[model samples]
Target chain A: MSLSSLPSVSTARSTASLTADAAALPPRAERFGRALLGSLLPLCLLALWALASRQGWIGRDLLPSPGDVLRTTETLVLSGALFHHLAATLARMLAGFLIGAAAASLLGALAGSSVLVHASLDPLIQGLRSVPSIAWVPLFVLWFGIFEASKIALIAVGVFFPIYLNLASALARTDSRWDELAAVCERGRLARFFLIALPASLPAYITGLRSGLGLGWMFVAAAELMGASQGLGFLLTDGEQTGRPETVLTAIVIFALCGRASDRALAALAARLAWR
Target chain B: MAEAVAVRDLVVNFGERAALGPVSFTLAEGSITALVGRSGAGKTTLLRCLAGLLAPSRGEVKMLRGQGRPRIGYVFQDARLLPWLSVAGNVAFGLTHLPRAERREAVAKALAQVGLSGWAHARPGELSGGMAQRVAIARALARAPDLLLLDEPFSALDAFTRRHLQEELRLLLHRVRLTVVFITHDLDEAIALGDRLLVMAGPPGRIVADLPVSDTGGALLKRQVLALLEGSGEEALQSPTLRVLAAHAG
Candidate 1:
């Protein structure tokens, strides 16, 4: 809560705080207590959910009891079905993210660095970004034929737009004074991009990547729904077709957990890499 | 002293209007030339031109260049160190051409020169304004440039920090065989740091006066520079004899 605890970025406060005794951070136990406090609302919501299911406030067909969903999850795990489905979806998400991020970064750099490139390419990119990613699913299935490639291609399309948007804007917003420094130092174009533009845009690029990953998760469900046999999306469809609400609830819970976990991982990585 | 950088009737245009120029001057190698002017006088425009960050619309800037010579080292008003880089990495930014060992040595030497050898691994965001400016100086010195260009490098610091840096910078430059083009509006700072003074004036900025800092007559020179900036005073600008003589060692 002290100024010293804040990141020393603003020149005035940072300078003044330079001589001010650094305020000690809270003890480990107190810090841990604060973290636990953050989960209070989610835990309360889960308790409400359990009570509603227990009292049959929602019909069993509409909302399965929490116990039923947990039992279903355990059965799926014991049968190794959950692992197989979850692993398949994670693999697809990773592949889509890697492909999407690479392609977006290349095109984004082009657009951001040159006004000519932005003029020539931004309209098309923006137009494409405006299209709902799910709209591409049918076309991708038709072209790649309901295989892993089609699913990956669809997710990649979803991931591409946000990362591309963030990176282009971030690069555009980079401080021009560094470019002046590069010119004075006689650095080449490539050097300027790598030395100044790249690091300057990294925090935003990571934000874009995190959003792209979430979008990829959304499309992964849609991707698997396009006739996947072994995935969480397939499990959802199977639960619905078989009229088992608990199975569907189990899949939803897993999706929530996985998405939260991935985002948290990325946030931790950003903390390490953002401003050094 | 030898000629290190020459500006010949240089002019820069921001659209149709002239922002600087028909400005001409020569930097004596190993000498510190302080350019003094009012805020709108375009000292920065001229410095940018000399630093090759801006191109002259008319005339040119010719620097002494040859094999093994590095490009110009520039320091802006603020520290401007890349926040992500460590002190050593920031100093080593422009030294990528050197071998790894030589680069390390140069970074160490530069940091040491600024009295920041112990803080080589610290982040710029962690430093005070004075410390950050010292790191900026180290970054410039690491390149071992023959010519260094500074645009009011210490103007953002507190008065005490500013005065302290001026003294430290003067001593540091004295130890190196480097020529400097310093831009500042403060006549006291200019006189304290420079061997020669160039006074600039106007929208289409031009150097209206040139004078040397005489060790015996600091107050007199300060008054003259103030008057020149105020469009009144000494005729040293009118005579070729004074202009040539001002380039000599202080």
Candidate 2:
């Protein structure tokens, strides 16, 4: 009837509202300054850790100095041990992430589009989602036998739910107005799904991917820690068993770097697609 | 003008409740009609019926072709633009069935028609409310659909922008004769744009009065529409309508 009659206008779309105000980019110098400022806190933290270890405020047995951790990393890299561990973990995470994301998005899209599918699948998914990441470790290890398969499966589990939930909810919550427009446009079901539903769901889907990737890293750590012979997780165990604090610290630093790098890569992709 | 559509005794229900019609009307080809009503008055339901989005529970809406099959262009209350697409891409949305070169030409022409030349590359986020709405209108125009349906397309806009677009719509029509049906709560907007007016009212919505406005904005017509939409819809419905004899709109 009247525009006033509709429950709410969808002009304030969650997807658009986030980026609507971001029309203009900040100056290069300003953006560079912001990035420099972002690094300041971490740099300060590094300085403090180095100071603490040097002054004996924190003993090397407890927390190694930044220099000791960096030297250990250097040794690992030169000896090719770091590459071996990194490649092993990256490969596992990649496989797990691909499997988990593919399955989640496929199901999520179906559930989002149809009530019957959602009703059929959501309860089981929600129930499984509640089961702790660590809890799955024993069950997976038993099934896959304390090997790469079990480790990868655990990572996949971690990656799945965030993606599934985010994607499903996003697609499900898409503004009905677009559906009306599609009806008016006389779009086929396939065109509606791909052209309207998918694009509308992209922001949340990307957000889901980011969260899934983050959880993938966390679950990979847990997976490797539980039963691994060659990973950063294995390095953590090796350092712990050998009483080498520097080696553990090295592994932690590498994990942090890798996680940050992977997240940045996805974030870059998001930026490219975000109202650009 | 040929008859564009004939909606006869159309009724729509949402579960137990009647949402629209049990009313009847016919549309003239290349005519501009406005449906004026309060909230929940079945204006959108009727519009959707014409667009083939809603099926009537009773009665039927028949579209009588004049020449080639009529393509429909709809402008929703909100822009309903795809945020990922550029302004040109959004305009090109319906033109996907056309060849690429034809689609591109239509997009450029539609954008230019809406006075949005050189805005092809701008993202939806970059545009203001008025600009975005203009892009939406351009998107509708790019399809070159002879039957145009707008649902309060300018109501969400500022008064100045709304008035500007209203005038622009009239100007655009001068270049191409098309049948247009728009719904608005604003009596003034209905009178300003419509060649014929369908004033609708109620929870079980029906047309209370169907009136015509002359080229000069209809002041007398506005008062009747306002009264029909005021409180209980029955005031106009129970009374033997003047237009039933004079207009014979149905």
Candidate 3:
């Protein structure tokens, strides 16, 4: 029961040393493991689906088999219809999310640093943040019509609060001692912000950005579902109208896949840039 | 001799509570002074005021006598390094006015003087407590300031590291002849490191004692001087450490 003697300190050290050595050489093994995991995940999901369909675990009409969904997806891919719809969704998400995140960071820094600014605007922002972006759909429609403006507005609203709150909280947590230290060092106010405040707040800002992207994806889909002629959501609506369960499942699968890919890409980019 | 630091009627108050002097003190040019006191004694407060990190509630801190630029270097107890910066970057943070090559060379020389040549690229988080403190000292050293203010710079360090750094500090001061004011609760540290010790005590801070110490001064002289400032305890003169420990224990 006791295998305490199996790996001594030296043994553990050598093993760690070997791993470190391998890690120093381009990370190919790590990349291969990631690729293998990526490939296996969908395969496992498909196998589960096939088993379910064969046994009639769920009604075939409601939940199409992976094969049926794949056929629909392949057709859409060949026709480049999925690509067109995906591009539209991505464009809206990126544009709206960037605009919301930038404005929030700037305003958040201002509010966080100045008590007067925070006092003037904090109650209004808190009230606005509490209201869901989806609840604004009717108002947005009236304000900007059913075009892309409404969708962008909804997505921007969804993404704004998380980024703003996170950034503001981060800036608020900035130690006054650091500012005093900077003054002692004779650094200017702008230099102090760039060197200390910005770097210190980066981790919190990144956390906010990550959460905002999730909300953004959710809002974009909801906006499309409520009103859109051509999108993945529209395709789902089209499938429902046509009475094609397979096409509906294909559209849902594509939406999930794109969302996962975007999140993964974001995580990868965050890994590269984030300090801690 | 030029006046390194000239202060007149320096007063600092935390609301109604007084922290430091309405008293006056002059720091002679290129001399080391130690500020000593019990806990909550305003030693650190006085050091901070001199460093320009804190403005006096009422008083003038004339760092330079007339026209020359007055650069003040600082070494804090915790070695408050920027976690994200490499040792070289942290050391060179204040030296932007210098050319890039000169700055790098200065950082390199400062690190070498602190016996941290190998740790130039390491992050502060990656260093030991002693190493981190050394880097902080190197950072101040690199600034080549007119006045160096250290607040318990080596109190947190291990005994061996503390002794080594004390020696290093003594040698660095000899080479650069920088004016320094160090704060410490330790009497031995004050005696060993200071050219003059200014002991401040209680309520509205007033200088209780001003004792001059020299390299030639023996342990007996140090004990006698500290004993004089600490007030009467006939038995306390035998051993200063034991006396201080006994007083604290009681």
Candidate 4:
């Protein structure tokens, strides 16, 4: 009677007992559970950081406590400074990523389809890909100025090579049998591309897109660090100049959060694109 | 037994090098023909040409079916089902333009025909070798093709599965009444499946022997054929006509 007094708690206990074997769940559900656990790990780390700082186990000035970083983040959010910087960085990334992906796809398709294109451009692409996006920042700044163009250009260049390589390889390795079947069906070039080539290369394209997006973000951060009035990267530079560890930590946290969120968004988009 | 396919002086070359050529043949409709030869005897090349997957470098391949271009289907040596697609999807690949409901019905009918009704949703990679080959057959049959070309479709199967598929193929052919052109290295297969048996010679391939196996399925005819081959071997030593054919085939 005493245990039955809390009926809801008793029912919850019974449900928990029934669902004890977590491994019996479907793979998709299991994957989601694992991702949720991974998400919680960062929060746990933050809590631990806050605890250690509170106990004076770590210095607050050199490495700001989680509380201090949170306070700075909250102040920046209230004043609307963080939002402006976040928006700038995001806009640059978006513009650059789209341009890069489109260009890569077109050029890669050409290179993959024609022997002459491959013979002429493959070496050049390989050489250029070895050079980091940051290395181009100086020349980009000189040519395009400190405005949005330089930043976007730098990000686009950063994203281009991976997408190009993936697309080219995808085209090269297309199922010859499918192509032959299409030929037998009397499908022309355009029809073949839409019906077969595009769908066949979609998985590779999405994979490249994911990598490109990540690279775009990295390049944006570097571009912002070099020069930019309003961006998370600028925030880091400002914090360094003023010797404010809390502000620096806040900017870093925001950058990391945005990067992880963008990855999830891209992953969601990719999953939708490749639903088949 | 009207001629459905007629090939005259068919020459296939890979760039400058000839694979097989100057071989003339005719195939009758609603009957199965088997091309039996050693490896590199252009059996596959000939089948591929008949399937329209490969164009002969020189020669006329006149396929005579009364209608517009007849739908020709090919079953490769391997099943060649798309790994990403389910067994049903693989069968329905040629039916891509069909409406969803029609495709579903077609897929169900094909899977049922192949005795794989319950395994519709299974991926090609998940299936056994024999099951995959059945899926390939289903893929071809689903198209309702006028001519079906099979290149060693059951060569890799275990003895039981091979025999089972052979019987299934025979039944399917009877039900559909479609023309078949099969290529194989096995005499037993040629004896079992073929209406007309064509034996090919090496290098620039030519037809050395052509025989009608007729309705004989047992080994008696096989032994008789072997005896004839041995008897012919001695005849080749003396007769110039047999000598050239033997030399080229050897």
Candidate 5:
């Protein structure tokens, strides 16, 4: 047969094979089992920790037994202190994150869209970003005092840089080809910004938000450590001063769990925003 | 009224370098003009000038609209659809000035025209390349433009999809009868679709030749266009070669 008249054999074969391969895949339960198996090492580490504690291989003063940590957790939960501290930390994190994210996105967009704004502000912003969040703590404390304002300011500062840099770069890098379409469609400058430029930069903006929130959590701890009556940071410091290793371990665990949970939540949000 | 687009001594320069034009042309309304050129030939520069996306360093482009400003639609080399929007939403983008019902009706009609009526809710990322290009065409159609500018709209597609889309575009033009200026690198495409073909050439690009495509003389015209583009200037023209050289020099 001539080339044009040949049957589309390869196409048909590929489709059939794809269908067969999909059908041959294992069930959902087996996939779940595989995922669970992947976590075996971390579970083993926990088992080892319990074993070491029961045998007293490590001194109780330096490293509290898992049982001791659990008992402390129970006491804290019953007295509602754990929930109180967690709630306070969450509130501070949310407030600072919203403020910082809002400012960064607005400024970043301005810088990205206009050459003048970028030239005027980018150097200073970049310079400030290089300074560690912890280094700003003393200055923030002096400026805002030892109140909630200082803590919030510290968290907000921590959250600002990643979001600003990411969003500004994203906006600047948005495809110029779309501008031609906008012109032909007779869309005005403002309309193009809202409908095209902003939406196009969303994936980058979402990424910046995730990174900012992670840093926001870290800064909140630093802020609370320096001064403040409540929060996880305070609990850690207080545990140290009181010689309660169990309380310190409990606080660290809570911080890790909360950080992971918040990161996961932000990731889900980013996925939803980046549905395209 | 023939509503022609008259370009007068247009020149575009980037920094110290000229990109296109110390040339002039007029495209009569309701006609398709295919602009064929090599890469970096400034066909895109000319199109952008016409679309008012880029300002020419020198010269004026006048579109003789009968009344108000003429509505213009443009399709780029790539689909260039907004990824966040659905097919229908992208089509409806230019129709925001219209009333809601009118916009919806326009979008539906455009989608139907492009054979994408059922894919209205699909995101741009979900569609295949051909489908996305069709959506881009639908977006241009939804505006009901008097003039449509296409910059290599089907050049990225495979042969089968390109031919299919070319046929569909021809049908669309026959029904709409809008003025069109299409850019292409394919000589056959220019011959098949254009009523008039403009060939561009040079490091500092300019339109080298403008010829009408006669039904029986497409092959001869293609040969001439190829010769001109390849810088075989003397061989392309049957008239005196020295005169053509003098004209180019001047």
Candidate 6:
């Protein structure tokens, strides 16, 4: 008998159920409306800020007027200072994230595959995990000096732990059934690790990477506050010392936007790579 | 018939508790043996031991092999497809050592055998349970194993899906000519699928009865097997037909 002639009982059932679920979902316009509704509060707050500044209710020295901040932002953009600082911060963030994520994933994979390695290293990792990234900043500066190395080291430390811990746990928690399947297939140890273990642990690994990226941004800012002269964090400190509220607000805004953009990008990449 | 699998005093233990054996059996080549037992009767343990997933606490299992490496295919209760891989990719998983062209051909053949040729690019997540299980079977089939081991492969599906796949699998097995040992708790499924039916009973788990299934006596054999499963050991031993079956099995 031809396979095509056979009735697709389960497939039909699943398809019907999925169709019903899709039907029950809110329409596309309603989803768009909901997203638009979510943005209302933020827009309202921005409007209020502008209104108060226009009414002279907020002192310009203490809190820059929206108009003044906008003017300052335009000046910075035209002068290319904003781009230079933004590029510096972004470069530091990417470099630190790549270094930290690479090392953590490699170490995590090793530890996850071997119980002895995990047992030996887990306590040390767990101990270091509790210390804030800022706490390591002074020590890092002392050791590496207040150059790009210290700042990069600080961000890397901040990025490393989350990826390491999550990836390790993910590897440990990999469904034993997959290993059994690999064994049954007569897959070699290297094949099992690369094909089964690595892919199986990816969802958790991606989660770790995303968290690490967010922390990377935070650590880069903190590191720059100490001895950096070119990054956004430097801009923040410089603004504070000069009592330029506009500059400080600009730095904060840029950081918020960059953080959000990087997170979204990471999420997109993870979604593409994730099994589920 | 040549023996495809032979076992002697196989035993499996977890810590202090014995899970299976002090049991033994020889399965003929190109035969389907259904292992029926109550839940926790160590049927899975026995199958796992045969697959070399778990080491036996005592004794040995030997498969009849000629010169080359032994190939064993295992189908678990779950489909166990790597969620990231496409259907073709999953089927071709065990064929990684083969040349790319051979691997693709093997994957295509396996998928066709399971009637999933059209779904080569689909992800496992998109597949229905029965379809996913079929993919799992195809994955195993791609390896062209000497022996196939299935642990309640159809038990997770709905009755209709299970029944459909059982028929499909029976046909597939006939075409492939592979030796198979499958575990199940359903008496009817055992009767329907197996050339030989082995019953396991116990706290420590041992095979109590092994019957060579003849096509003519299926209903009667099923009833006797059900009785032996439901009744006490003394009653099972007292049944004359069961006695003959057990004697024939030995």
Candidate of highest lDDT: 6
Of the true interface contacts, each candidate retains a share of 0.30, 0.40, 0.16, 0.06, 0.40, 0.46
Model 5: per-residue Cα lDDT over B130-194, one tens digit each? 77888898898889887899999998988877877787787788688888999998888888888
Q: Order the candidate numbers by TM-score, best to worst.
A: 6, 1, 5, 2, 3, 4
lDDT of 2 by residue, B1-250 (tens): 7888888999999899889869888888888899888888889998988887888899997778656656789998889888888889889888866899999999999988887776798778766677788888888888888688898898788886677777777778656678889998777777777888987788788887777778764776676666556646766666544444235544
Q: iRMS of each prediction in angstroms? A: 8.1, 8.2, 11.7, 18.0, 7.7, 3.0
- Over 4 Å off in model 5, which ranges? A1-34, B1-3, B233-250
The ten-residue window of minimal lDDT in model 2 chain B covers B241-250
Deviation in angstroms for A38 in model 4? 5.9
A1-276: candidate 2 lDDT, tens digit per residue: 222122222343344545654445666888899999999999999899989999999888989888888889899999999999999999999999999999999999999999899999999999988887799887887898988999998899899999999999988998888888777666778988888888888889999999999999998998888968999999999999999989998888889999999999998988877543
* lDDT: worst 10-residue window of model 4 chain A: A1-10
Q: Summarize candidate 1's per-residue lDDT along B128-152 as a digit string, tens digits.
A: 8878888888888888887898999
Cα lDDT tens digits for candidate 6, A53-112: 878898888887777788888999999999999999999998899999998988898889
Ranking by DockQ: 6, 2, 5, 1, 3, 4
Cα RMSD to native, each candidate? 4.9, 5.3, 7.0, 9.6, 4.9, 2.6
Model 5 pairs in collision = none
Q: How accurate is candidate 1 locally (lDDT)?
A: 0.83
Instruction: Identify the leading candidate in terms of TM-score.
Output: 6
What's candidate 4's i-RMS value?
A: 18.0
TM-score of every model versus the real structure = 0.89, 0.88, 0.85, 0.80, 0.88, 0.93
Tell me model 6's lDDT, rounded to 2 decimals. 0.86
Query: For candidate 4, what's the TM-score of chain A, rounded to 2 decimals?
Result: 0.85
> Any runs in candidate 4 off by more than 4 Å, and if so which?
A1-59, A120-124, A184-186, B15-18, B83-112, B115-131, B224-250
How many backbone clashes can be found in candidate 1? 0
TM match of model 3 to true structure: 0.85
CAPRI-style class, candidate 4: incorrect
Colliding residue pairs in candidate 2: A1-B44
